[model samples]
Target: MTAARTPLYEEHVRLGAQMTNFGGWVMPLQYSTIREEHHAVREAVGLFDLSHMGELRIGDETLVQRVLSRDVTRLRPGRIQYAVLCNDAGGIIDDVLVYAMPDRGYLLVVNAGNQDGDFDWIRKHAQAADAARNVGREWALIGVQGPRAVDLVQRLTPSDLASVKYYAFVDGTVADVSCVISRTGYTGEDGFELFCGNADAVRLWRALLEEGRSDGIRPAGLGARDTLRLEAGMRLYGNDMDAQTNPLEAGLDWTLNLEKDFIGRDAIMTSRQRGLARQLVGFKMLDRSIPRHGYRIVSDGEGVGTVTSGNVSFTLGYNIGMAYVPPAMSEPGTRLGVDIRGAAAPAEVVPLPFYKRPHPK
Candidate 1:
């Protein structure tokens, strides 16, 4: 299959970004270096082209509530809610963000790789209650994230950026292009995601770079996005959990509304009643070695679980990772060892969100 390219593909290349295949899309891996881009977002500001993600517009709130794990009825217009799409067995199909558009419809943003499967699952269940349109191809999604993101973005748009609270949004023109400016991000920082027409992507990207030039904003890529999100303890859809992972065991119970009727609710409820054998937990390496996916985690000299998402945290300058282990061994401060190559490297269970953004004064 031919790999797809975003509207900003040429722009990335022009900036001398290293390109790579990601979720079947050719995207920028980095413009300069991964570590440099990582710190740019952590300390100052960074821009990202996220046009590869999928978007579905559904008109029916009832069908939306019935399809997604979160209660769509609870979301007021102009707000956004993070949710999961589950299969009949209660395994996650894809984690998504449901945006309650200012009017009656809702927009679902899903992972790039799960776009087709998610659309099919949603449409099959939606029937005639809603119209599901794959609007991803027509859109360009840009993320401006960091400590100074808001100040940088506020300079170009007439909309009141300060009034837009976290997980909420407003429709406005950004750099003269109509857009949905959303105060939502994956990096656990104050940021905005601009959704605009594909034709306007390059102009918007250039405008942002120019406006933020004095503020030290640089184009960041997937490599930095991963490290930043990992530090923030945000789960990557495929890396952290997949169709085989349930919300309860993946440390995402907060995103589930069990009282509401939805697909796979019964299966999840049943799993709750039976109890989970293992649950996801965070850990920091005591040794210098970084953990990788599928690395064995041992406790009491026996294999216990496997690492799912692991990385060398750029902010903390240490190896951090998340994995599933017996519920008893999931507590913070529990000593564990990870098999790094042939060595049993020491590690210990730590709290989720290895990094936290400072509160605004």
Candidate 2:
């Protein structure tokens, strides 16, 4: 079967991006270099095509509650909430962002690879009166990330950008195209994600690039995006957690609202009662070696766990990673070793988010 291509496929090729298949979609892996694009997002601004992500519109509050891990009804219009979709077994199906639209409806932005599965899961549980629409293919999502993102995006829209606080959104016209602009991003930076129709994607992308030319806005790709998110300590669905991993062990307790009865609450409670066997923790390499997925983690000269996500933080110039280890060995300041290619490399557990952006005055 042939892989699908996003609306920005031709545009990426024209811009000389190196393309690769991601979640069955042909996407840009890098434009120039991963390090350069990664630094651009940290120092200036970077544009990303997140059109591959799935968007679902669910109108029923009761149905939303049953499918989400958080209190979706508590979110007022124009706000956004981060939550996870759990299976009956209490394992995560996907980590999603819920947007409370001005129309009193909810928009869910889900993982690209899990789009079909998530849709099927939601539909199967949805009541006959409940309505859920797959809007992923109908809209293109553009992520403008960094400190300068707001300034550049504000120029193209009449909406008061500053009025839209973090995790909030507004409906407005951007460069003559109607869109939903949200003050949210995955790179742990102050940025805006513009949701526009597929027909206007190229135009909006080019317009943002032209408007932000002086601000060092570069077209970034998946490679830089992965590194940026890893530096921020964000969990990737397939790697960090899956159907077998629960929220409590993945360090995502904040996203779970067990007070409200949702799917998997019982299983989650069961896991809590049984005690967590392991927990996800962040670490920095003490030796000159890079960590990779599936690398064995050793504590006291015995295999304790394995690395889920690992990378050399281009911005920090240090090798950092996250691994699932026994809860006893997951605390900060704990010493451990990563078996990199059969050689044990010393590492130390550290607080998550190896990189943190400076707060604006």
State residue 341's C-alpha deviation in candidate 2, in Å: 1.1
lDDT of 2 by residue, 73-157 (tens): 7899999999999999999999999998778889999998999899889999888634888999999999999989988998889
Worst 10 residues of 2 by lDDT: 125-134
lDDT per residue for candidate 1 within 27-125, as digits (tens), equals: 999999999998888888999999999999998888898889998887999999999999999999999999998777999999998898888888898
lDDT of each: 0.92, 0.92
* Runs off by more than 4 Å, candidate 1: none
What TM-score would candidate 2 get against the native? 0.98
For model 2, which pairs clash? none
Residue 250, model 1: Cα distance from true site in angstroms: 0.7
Report clash pairs, candidate 1. Answer: none
lDDT of 2 at 226: 93
